[model samples]
Target: MTSRQRSAPASILQGVEALLRPLAVFRADLHRNPELSGQERRTAERLARWLGHAGCEVFTGVGGHGVVARLRNGEGPLVLLRAELDALPVREETGLSYASTVTAARPDGRVVPVAHACGHDIHMTCLAGTAELLAANRASWRGTVLLVGQPAEETLTGAAAMLDDGLYQRFGVPDVALAQHVAPLPAGVVAHAPPGEPLTAAGAELRIVIRGRGGHGGMPHLAVDPVVVAASVVLRLRAMAVQERRPGEHVVVTVGALHAGERANVIPDSAVLEAIVRAPSLAAVDRVVEVARRVVEDECLAARCPDPPEFTVVTRVPAGISDPVAAARVRRAHLAVFGAGRVVEVPQGQASEDFPLFGADGRVPTVYWYVGSVPPAVWDRAPGAGPLEKLHSLPAAHSPKFSPDPVATLRAGITALAAGALAWLGTGPLGNGEIMSFGSLP
Candidate 1:
């Protein structure tokens, strides 16, 4: 590493620290005014406005509220830093002063509460801080920086939506793509999975609708009992991984939702199940899908369903793999900034992310890492405590109650992202007047 690179961490921290307060307030504002997927009109405009003031050439409404801001420095490779712009359809339970009380109307026309249950507010704030640092320290690193504000990530469609609308074609592909997700780890700590290890599993949304005859509650034989069939389907789906998957293969089948009858004494005509299938590989995901289809059909048939069961593949997203080389560089950068004790190893995650689509099919080298969001006091008090008393004490992402320590979490995020970006942008063929290539991929 260059002497300049060795000293870059301190420089980055100094720059980010100055912007921490505004960034925290920005995050709180975002948390207060959460918007749902593809409906991030206000969020996108707010991000664009900030980036524009930071000297970035901003483009709004790229792919239905996706924003792209470019800050070009002379003669170097391009790097993309991405952040999600949408929020989830979850009501706030955190009870914080900035907690979202905002409700948005879904496409189905039902109004529902919205909140940043997944910490996109923090992600966006960090992106803003990074933009500020990079813009201020342009002379320290030479390259084009593209800050992407993506929408609909909660639905796993935003990244693809942006790409389909010509994300790369319009602004050009990036040599390196960087993004960070907030985890439940203690504030100020950053984590990365081992090199070559999978970051997040590929995901497929499975929707099953089981059809049966409806009748009065007293006539048990007449009703066909679609609910029983639905329960059977759920149990079999769980067994799929154990019975079908290889010894070392990883898989998860979660039945997230089920809906059927509304009345207490009446049997419903059909039951619907919404499940998520996750696996380390696309083939495994495909296998799970196939098995799930057969399972639903066979179970319904065994129950003497009046009609064929309905199956729909709602959405499919590819697995996320960290580029070994890029990841190693980012890891080293984290170690430099936070020290060895604060930089920890992260296990492969079961949760799915559409961030991979930004570098779809490995078209761009990407490093997606985690930033700790749990308050230090809480994390410190977890030791010697039971799992339920400790881990369960803090709310996990996706819960309406999930809340990150705003200031510390924001600082940690800005550090990891800006440090990692500088690590890659500071070195390599790009800075030496050569282009970046994934070698075998392109």
Candidate 2:
């Protein structure tokens, strides 16, 4: 490492520490008032305010409720840092003082509790904090920092919406796009995928409608029950994970949502199933999707349905693959800031993300990593002896009880992001000098 880069660790930690209190408050406020996909108007406003306060040229409503902020400091390499602004339809059960009591209606007019169960609040807080830190220590780096507050990430459509709205054409294409996710691992640690392995899976979202004849509940053999067929399809799809999986290959097939008849006395004409299929590659996703289609068709045929089922491909996202060179550089920077022990290597995860779309299908370099969010004490007390066991024992993303260690997570995330940006931007005049005053948090 360059002497300039070596001298910045203490300042990075100190700057991040200074920003923790306000950032924690910001995160808690977001956690309490979470918004769902495509409904992040307030979230976008608050993020824009924070970015603008940090001296960034903030742009709001880029793509449906998306916000982009640019901080140009003489321009070396343009680094894009992204964070999700949307939350999940889960009721918060964390029991934290700032737990969400918010509820919103879905497009179908069904009300559901909303919460930041996936740690997007932490992501945005960290991104904003990083923007503040980089702006404060501008002399330590020379480049453009593009901060993106992407919406509808839970539905996996935000990245595409932003790109379609000309995220690159409006702002310049980035030299490197960087993003990180908060996981259930111990706080103050970061993990990256190994070389040549995908950081996250390639996945597809499908909406299937199984059709059948409708009849009264008293009739046993009169109506071809679509609900029964749907149940069969779900079982077969679950079996596909074990039956169709190849050696050393990972695939996840989930029947996330299902809806059928509203009354017990009536047999519905059709059953709607919302499912997700994820695999290490798109080809595998396709294979699993084909199997799912076949299973639905065969089950319908067995039930002698009057009409064919409707299978709609809602969306497909490619696997997140990091650029080798960019990954190595950021990994090095993370190690320098957090030390080698805190920055560890991890296997490719089954969870999927649309973050790879920022790469514009391999046209741009993208690097993504994981930031651990479980507090030290919590991790130590979890029912596990090893990292993997502890990870499984904790409340994972999308769970109602998933709560991150706000202070430790925000601190580590901000430092890691700042260091990664600096790794690409290169050190400036004051980079090797003493820590500069960060002014005050907004």
Candidate 3:
């Protein structure tokens, strides 16, 4: 068969020509109205209105800004589809024609313009389109499809909040859960792995606050400056690279933010610290968290000052792993859509995702895939994002100049989700037992 004919599942391509325009609009509309994490009130309203019209029984106000909709056709496995509903705090750097028109006051008392730098725009749009397609043809499938629009992924609080609100309990969970993210990879291409390999992710954030007494800058002997204690903390954190921890385990600790002083001469009373840690396993993460705390405690005691309670070992993001069996189904769907050559095992990333909280029961398996969204110009220009600047850097996703090939990205996401859903439902002639199997391929 020709390459043109070797496209996604027929269920996706059948009405592709018709979905182009509206899908484009959906992407643009979302791009113009990016909302911050945990504060996705307006974003929830838009999703609610759309899902309501899509012939699904929609529910709103779930887990802060979350929205859940249910479409029941016949008795089959319940599938959960999730899309995050949050935006980055970046001021638009990418001067695209259709940039963000939404701006809100941030928690830190700053009013920053919001943009869909993380491609959540396409995610929401894809969920909407997928729901519409599947719901419109309810007769072709069985079982209940649960579509969830989660909030605050940027803060890594959405999924946790949703579950805290009884998402799985009241919602009756699912046999398999699926979600996809856009990558800075080549546009329109999809990357997903099968069971027994890498998939999705989970991790945490560390906030360390070292408090000390502030006095005259000149009198170093008198003032128990917190900055000095903070300095030791920084060095210890930096030293994690050389310091031996677990055997053959990768635990990354990055001190992203440090603040504690005012004026050149005056010392501050406290220093606040924030860092992100990424680990493939829960045990490794716990080990690192304990070590970090021990370091902070030791430093505080050595400084001869009372240890501040503000020095915390808080966790923001949870480690999300792609279920072995569920991942295989996603892999088959991606292969069918992007073809074998285009489908690949996504590289293990240090970046963290909170999708793990949804499938905590181990019943509703969630597999989050990546779709390449590298700006066409950048993709052609540089060899890659390189060592210094990355996808979520100031000049990448959060930049005003970071314009995505929205159509290309959206098409791949929609096709992936739609094809994934169809294959999940055991629709058409893909073979029911052969479609999604556990452990290994038959």
Q: Which candidate is the best by lDDT?
A: 2
Ranking by lDDT: 2, 1, 3
What CA RMSD would you report for each candidate?
Answer: 5.6, 5.3, 5.2
lDDT of residue 165 for candidate 3: 93
Which residue pairs overlap in candidate 2's backbone? none
Off by over 4 Å in 2: 1-13, 428-442
What would the TM-scores of all predictions be?
Answer: 0.90, 0.94, 0.86
lDDT per model vs. reference: 0.84, 0.87, 0.72
**What ranges in model 1 sit over 4 Å off?**
1-9, 383-393, 427-442
Which structure is stronger by lDDT: 2 or 3?
2
TM-score of 1: 0.90
lDDT (10s digit) by residue, model 3, range 1-442: 3332233347444665567688788778777888998788888888878888888888888889899999888888788899988998777766777788678897756587788888788889889888878777665667888899999988788888888998888888788888888876667666665445545444667888787777778877876777788788878976874473466556677887777876878877777878766666766766677777888888887887555535555555555667877677676666665666556554566667788777766666778787777655656565424412334342455445666677777777777887777766646223122322211110
Cα lDDT tens digits, model 1, 33-106, are 99999899999988999999999999988878999999998878788999999998898899899889999898
Per-residue lDDT of candidate 2, residues 263-326 (tens digit): 9999999899999999989998999899888888898988899999999888899898899888
In model 3, the worst 10-residue window by lDDT is: 433-442
lDDT of 1 at 326: 82
